[model samples]
Target: MDEVLTCENSRVKFFPIMMYAMVMGMSGLTIMYQKAALWLGFTDMIGHLLMMVSTTLFVVISLIYLSKYIKYTPMVKKEFSHPIRLNFFAAISISMLMLAIIYKEVNVNVASMFWYTGTVLHFYLTMYTISFWINNNQELDHSNPAWFIPVVGNVLVPVGGVGFASQGVLMYFFSCGIFFWVILFAILLNRIIFHHQLAVKFMPTMFILIAPPAVGFLAYYKMYGVIDVFATMLFNLALFFTLLVAFMYKNFIKIKFFISWWAFVFPLAAMSISAMLMYHETKDVILLSLSYVMVGVTTMVISVVMYQTVSHVLKGEICVQE
Candidate 1:
C-alpha cells in the first residue's frame, strides 16, 4: 500500500514538469512555423496556421494545468477570474484576426491591433497565473536550493513573456510601462543576486526569458515608429548588457556543458534579428546588420552548449534539470 502511494505521488509530482515541457515545446513549434512563413513569403497563410496552433495550444494547456495542477491562492480565488476569461477572449480574437490576415480582408490597422492586443492578453494572463502559483505555493520550501534555480529562473519567463507580448501596446504608451518593467526586472535581478548564490549572471537561460519580449518590442518599433528613439536606445543597451553577461559567464564559470542552452540562443537571436529589422527601416543598416551577425554566431555557440548539456542528462550524468 505504501509503495503504491509513493508511486502515485511521484506521478503527481511529474505532472507539472511534463506540462511545462509540453507547453514550451508548443511555443517552439509556433516560433519555427513563424520563421518558416517569413522565409517562404507565405506569411498570410502560414501565419494564420501558426496563430491557430498557438491559440489551440494556449487554451488546451491552460485548461489542463489550471484544472489539475494548480493550487489556487486566496487572491486568485477572490480576485475576479479575469486572467482566464481574458485568455479565452484573446484566443477568439486571435482566431478572427488570423482569418483576416489570411484573407487580407480587413482594415490593416485594425487587424494589426487585434493581433497585438490578443497576444498581450494571452501572455499577461499566463504571467498572472504563473505568478499566483509561484507566490502562493511554489516558494513555501526555500530549503531546497535546486528548486530555487528553476523557480527563480522561470520567474523571468513570466516577466519576459508579459513584456514581449505587450510591446506593441507598450510602444503606444511611449515605452512608459516598459521603463517600469525594466526597473522591476533589475530589482528582481538584484534580489536573486544577493539572496541566491546561484551564478545566474552568465546563465544562457536568462536570455530565454529576456529576448522574446525585447524582440516583440522591437518588432512593433520597426513596424510602427511608435517610440523609435527610446526603443532603439533600449535595444542597443540590452545588446551591450547581454554581451557583458556572456563575458562574465565565460570568465567565471568555465561552462563545460549545455542542455537547455538552445532556449537562450533562440530568444537572443530573436531579439537581435528584431533589432536589425528595426534599424534597417531607420537606415542604420550597417551597425544593425553587424549586430545581427554577431548575435547569430553567439546563437550557434550556445546551441552547442545546450546540446552538450542535454546529452549529459540523457546518459544519467549531470542532473541539471533539477
Candidate 2:
C-alpha cells in the first residue's frame, strides 16, 4: 500500500509539457464565446464563466508543472530535447497569448503584460525549435501537426498585439508565421500521404491543420481592418480544412481519448471565431449560420474533452511514461 501511494505521488514528475494545451483549449473557448456574445447577441455570462475557469486552470497547472520542473529537472530537460515534445513547449506561450487576448478587454494593462511576455517567449522558442529541426537528423514520421505550435505561432501575435505593439513588429511575426506555415504544411502533407498514418495517440492532432489559415485570417483582419482577396483566400483555406476534418469525424470518434484530444478544441475555436469574423465583415446569412454551427460544435467538444480529462486524471491514466 505504501509503495502504491509512493508511485501515485511520483506521477507528478511525469507531467507532460503538452498539458498546457488544456489552457489553450479553454482559453480558445473563452474567446470563442466572447465573440459569439458580440456577434450573435448572446449573453456574455458564458464567456465570463469560461474565462474564470480557464484562468484558474492556468494558474493551477502552471504551479503543478513548475513543481515538476523543480523536482525532476533532468526529466524536464529530456523532454525538451525530445523531437516531439520540443514542439509543445510553445503551448505554454500560446496559453499566455490566449490569456492576453481574453484579458485585453477586461484589463489592458494585464493583457499587455501577458502579450509582451508570451510574445518574447514564443519568439525564442520559435528560433530554438526551427534551429533544432535544421540541425538535427530527425525521422520523417516525426513530423505531426504539433510542429505548427512552435514557429507558426508567430501568426497569433498580431491578433492580440495590434494596439500594444508597433505595426512593424506585428508584421514581422505575421510574415514569419505565414511563410513558415506553407513550408511546414507541405512537409506535413507529404508525411501524411507518403508515410504511415499518425499513431492513434496523435491522430487527434490532425485538427491542428485547421489553425494556420483560420488564425491567419483573424490576425490579418485584426492588423489591417479589411477583408481583401488575400484575406478571403486564408479564410477559404481554413474552411476547406474544417470540412475535411469534419468528414473524417468517423475515424476520430473511434479512437480512445488521449490528452491530444484537446487538440480538437482550439483549432475549431479558431475556425468558429473566423466564421464569426467573416459574418461580422460580410453580414452574409450563410456565414452567420456557419458561425452558429461552429460555435455549437466547438463548445460541445471542449466540454466533453474537459470532462474526459478529469475522468482520466482520476483514473491515473495521464502523465504516465510512454
Candidate 3:
C-alpha cells in the first residue's frame, strides 16, 4: 500500500501538470496585446514585453518538464491515458500558435516557422489521442470539456495560418476542427447529463466549452474578413456559453485553488478578443464597451491566479502532484 501510495504521489507531483496553466498566461498576454492595439488604439509596449517573457518561460519550463517526463516512463504512460493530462498537448499546440501570432506582425518568417511546426505537432498529437480513445481497454467514463482540447487546437490553426499558409491548408484545418467540435460537443453533453459528475477540482475546465466557438469566431473573421451569418452564429454560441458558465459561478467559487483554475483564463481571453473583433467589424459601442470590460476582467483574473500560484509555490504546496 505504501509503495502504491508513493507511486501515485509521484505521478501527481511530476506530471506535465502546469503546462496548461502556463499556456493561459501566454494566451492572456497575447490577447492583451490584441486588446490594446485593436480596441484601445495603443501600441501596448508592456503587452509585447510580457508576451516575450511568457514565451521564454514557456520554452524553458517545457524543456525542463519534457526532460523530467521522459525519465519517468510510468508517468509518461499515465499522461497519455489520463483525460486531464492529455489536454497538455492542446496547451503545447496553443502556446506555439500564440508565439506565431505574436511574432507575425514583428517577424513573418519566424512566425511561419512556429506556425508550421505547431500545425504538424498538433496533427500528430490529435491522431495519437484519438487512437488511444479507440484502442484503450478502459471505459470511456472520464470524458470532460478537456476532451475538446485536441480538436480545439485545429480550430485555432487558422488564427495564424491565414497569414502564413495557403487558403487550402487553412480550410482543411478549419473544417476538421469544426467537425470534431460538433461531435465532441454532443459526447461531452451526454456525459455531463448521464455519467458521473465531474469532480469539483475539474469543474473549472467546463469553461473550456467556450473556447472552440470563441476562437473559431476569431479564426473565421481572419479567414473571410466579414462577420457573415456563420461567423455571427459562432460568436453568439460563444456568448451563450460564456453566460451559461457565468451562471455556474457559485459552483466555481466553492472549489479550492488548483492549477486547473487557470483553465478559466484563456477561454475568457479568447472571448475578449472575439468581442474586440466584433466591435471592430460593427463599430457597435456596446461591443466596444464589452471588449473593454472583458479585457479588464481577464487581466484581473489572471493576476489573481498568478498571485495565488506564486504563493503556493513559495509555500511548497504546489510541488506535490494532486
Candidate 4:
C-alpha cells in the first residue's frame, strides 16, 4: 500500500511537466498545420496529412492529460464537476468540425463561407483560454516558469479570431495581441535565462518564445494584409538572431531522442512559410524566394537534429538533473 502511494505521488509530480510539454506540442502543431494547409493549397493531399497529424496529436495528448488529472470523486463523477476541461474538449471538437466544413469549400466561394466558421472556432478557443487556463494557472504548482507558454498561446487565439472576422477592425488588434504576449513571454524567457545560466547556456529561450508571435504576425498579415512588411520582417529577423545565438552556444550537434528539440522546428518552419507567402503577396521576388529556400533548408537540417535529440533523451543519453 505504501509503495502504491509513493508511485501515485511520483505521478503527480510529473503531471505538470507532462501537461506543459503537451500544450507546447499542441501549439506547435497548430501553427505548423496552418502553414501546411496553405502550402498544399488547402485541398491537396499534403494538407490532409498535416491536419491529421496535428489533430491526432492534440486529441491524444488531451485525453492522456484528462485521464491523468481528472478526479473520480463521487460528486465529480456526476458530470458537472469538470466543466473547464469538458468545455475545452468540446471546443476542440467543434473547431475540428468547422475546419472540416471549411475544407470542403476550397475553390468554391472561398472567401464568403470560409472565414465565419473559422472565426467562431477561434472565438470558442479564446473563451476557453480566458475562462479556464489563465484563471487556473495560479492553482497549478510548477517549478519552472516555462509553464507560461501555453497561457500566452491561449491568449493569442482571440487575435486570430478578430483577424478572421474583420480585417479592418481586427488587423491592428491582432498585431497588438502578438506584441502583448511576446512581451510577457520575453519576461519569462529572461527569468529562465537568469536561473539556468549554464544548463541551456548554448541555447537561449528568447528566440523560441518570440518565434510563435512572429509567426502569428505573419499569419495575421496573410489574413488581413493590413500590416507593413518591414514590421513583420523585423520580428523574424530578431528570431533569426536568437536562433543563431542558440546554435552557437548550445553546440548545434545532432543528438537523437529529445522531443522538445522538435518543438523548435515547427515554429521556425511556420514563420518561414508565412514570410514566404507574405513576400509573394508584396511582390518582393527576392524575399519570397529566400523565404521558401530557408524554410526547406532549415526544416531539413533542424529536423535531423531534433530527431536525434529525441532519441538521445528517450534512451537516457542526455539527462538533465533537476
Candidate 5:
C-alpha cells in the first residue's frame, strides 16, 4: 500500500500536468476533420466523434490533475517551477484554446465561454512565462521546441477569436506570437547547432518546430482572408519544417516513447489545416492532393500516439517520476 502511494507505480500522486497536451492533439485532430468535412465535401461524422472524445478527455484529465494538485501540492509546485516542465503549463491554456476552436461550429455560447476564459488565461501564462525566463538563468539544454508551446497559443488566438473578439484585440495576440516566434527560433537554432544534441527523450519535440508558422498561416488567413506573400511564407515555412522533421525520421523512430511524443500531433494537424487553407485560397489541384496526404498522415500519427499512450498507461508506465 505504501508502495502504491509512494513508489513509481503512484499514478495519481505522480500525474504529470503535461497530460494536457493530449487534449491539444485530439482537439487539433477534431478541427482538422471539421475543416475536411466543410472544405472537401467529406461527412462530418469523424469530426463529431473526435470532438466528443477530445472534450471528454479534457474534462477527465483536468479532474485527475486537480486531484493530484490537492493531494500533492509540493510535487505540483516543483513541476510548475522546473524549467522544462514549467513550459507545459501553457498546454492547459492551449487545450482551452483548442477546445474553443472545436466548439465554434457546434455551439456559440460554449465556444465563447472557452474563448474568453482561454484568452484571459493564455495571456497570463504568456506573461508569467516570459517573466520567468527573464528572471531565471536558464540552461541551454532546457531549450527545446517545447518552449514554443506558450507562444503557439498566442498565434492560435485569431483562428478562434476573430468572430468573438475585436480585430485589434486579436491583432495584439497575433503580433506578440509572431514576433517572439522569430526571436525564439534564433535561440533554439543556436542551441541545436553549437551545443549538445537533444536527449533521446526530447527528440519527438523537434516536430514542434513545424507548428508556429503553420498556425501563423491559419491565423493570418483568418485575419486577412487573403493568401498574400506573408501568408505564403508562413505556410511554406511550415511545410519546410514538416519536410525537415520527416528527413530526420531515424532520429525519432529509435527513441523510446515519452509522453512528449504528443508534441507531434498538433503541428502535423496545423500543417494539414494550413494546406487545406492554401488549397482553399489557390484552388490548386496539387495542394488539394497534398492536403489529402497531410490529412491521412496526421490521422495515422495521432492514432499511433494514442495507442502508445494507452498501452503505456495500462502497463503503469506513464505518470512515473522522470
Candidate 6:
C-alpha cells in the first residue's frame, strides 16, 4: 500500500494537477450565473459576487502553480512530454475562456482581452498537441478522452467569442473545434472500445467525452440564438453520453480518489448548464427538472472532491513527486 501510494504521489506534479481545482471552481461560477440564472433568477450583486470569488480563486491558483513550474524547471520539462500532462495547457486556455464568459457582462473590455488571449493561446496549444501526436512515436493505444481537451477548446471559443468577435471569426473557431471533435471522438471511441483498457487512474477522464458536445450546444446557442437541429443534436448526444457514463459509475467508485476526479466536475456542470439553456428555449418542465437534478449532483460531487483534496493536502499526500 505504501509503495502504491508513493508511486501515485510521484506522478502528481504542479502544472496540471491544480488545473482540476481551477476548472471545477470556474465551472461552479459559470453554472451559478449562466445557467442557474434562469431558474434561480439573476441579480447583478450575486453575479458579481460569484464571478469575483471564482475568478480570484482561479488567478491565485494559476500564479501558485506557475511559480512552482518556474522554480522546478527540470520537473516541468520532464513532464512536458507526458501525454496526460500536455492536456494541462488546454486547461489553462479553457480557464481563461471561462473567465471571458463570466466577465462579458461585468466588464466588456476585460472580457474581450481574456477572450482574445484564450483564443490565441488555445489555437497554439491545439497545434502543439496535434504536432506532438504526429511527431512522437507514441501509439494510439495511449489515446484517451483527455486528447479532446485542446480540440474542445476550439468548440468553446464561440462561447465567449460570440460577444467579442465577429461572426466570421466565431465560425472559424467553431468550425475548427467541431471538425476536430469529429476526428478525435471517432479515434477515442475506437480506442475505448477495442484498444487497451484504461488504467484506473484515468477512468475519471472518461467524463471528458461528455464535454465537447455539451459545450458545443452552449456555444451554438450563444452564437445563433436558437436551438436549431445541429444544436439539438449536440445536446442530445451530450445527454446520451452523460447517461452512458453514469451507468459506469461503479467503475469510477472502484478507483481511488485522485485530482483527476475533478475531470468529472466540469463536464457534469456543462451538462447541467446545457440543460438549463435547453429549458429556457423549450420551456419544458422535464428539462428544467433535469437541470435542477444536475445542479445538485454537480455541487455534491465537487464539494466532496474539494473536501477530499483539502484533506489530502493537509496530510501531505499531494504535489510531492517520488
Q: What is the C-alpha RMSD of each candidate to the true structure, in Å?
A: 9.6, 2.7, 4.5, 8.4, 2.9, 4.3
Candidate 1's C-alpha runs over 4 A off are 1-180, 192-196, 199-202, 208-213, 251-263, 283-285, 288-292, 309-313, 316-322
Quote each prediction's TM-score. 0.50, 0.97, 0.91, 0.57, 0.96, 0.90
lDDT of 2 by residue, 1-322 (tens): 1221233548878888888898999999999999999989989999999999888878877877788888899998999999999999999999999999999999999899999999999999999998998899989889999999999989999999989989999999999999999999999999999989998999999999999999999999999999999999999999999999999989798899998999999999999999999999999999999999999999889878988887878777787887
The full ranking of all candidates by lDDT, starting with the best, is: 2, 5, 3, 6, 4, 1
Clashes of each: 6, 0, 2, 15, 0, 1
Tens-place lDDT per residue, model 3, 1-322, is 1221233434444745545566656566576665678577867776677777777767665655565576766776777678657766667877777788877877899888888988988898888888877886645467778877777668888988886778888988889889999998898888788888888877988998889999899888888898999999999999899989988889887788887888888888888889888988899999989888878888887888777766765665664665
Candidate 1: tens digits of C-alpha lDDT, residues 89-198? 22232233232232223245544554455445444544554465446543321222122222222222222222233445434433433443454456546655666643
Candidate models: Cα lDDT each: 0.41, 0.92, 0.77, 0.44, 0.88, 0.77
Ranking by TM-score: 2, 5, 3, 6, 4, 1
TM-score of 5: 0.96
Error of 3 at 208 (Å): 0.7
Of 2 and 4, the candidate ahead on lDDT is: 2
In terms of lDDT, model 2 sits at 0.92
| Residue 160, candidate 1: C-alpha displacement in angstroms | 15
Pairs clashing in candidate 3? 12-321, 13-321
- Model 4: per-residue Cα lDDT over 209-320, one tens digit each: 5455555665455465565776566456645754564566445443223334544553455456556565656667766566656556555745565456446535544423
Which residue segments of model 5 deviate by more than 4 Å?
A: 1-9
Candidate 3: list runs displaced more than 4 Å.
1-18, 137-140
Candidate with better TM-score, 4 vs 5: 5
Better of 1 and 3 by lDDT: 3
**Which candidate leads in lDDT?**
2
Which candidate, 4 or 6, would have the higher lDDT against the true structure?
6
The deviation in Å at residue 192 for candidate 5 is 0.4
RMSD of model 4 against the true structure: 8.4
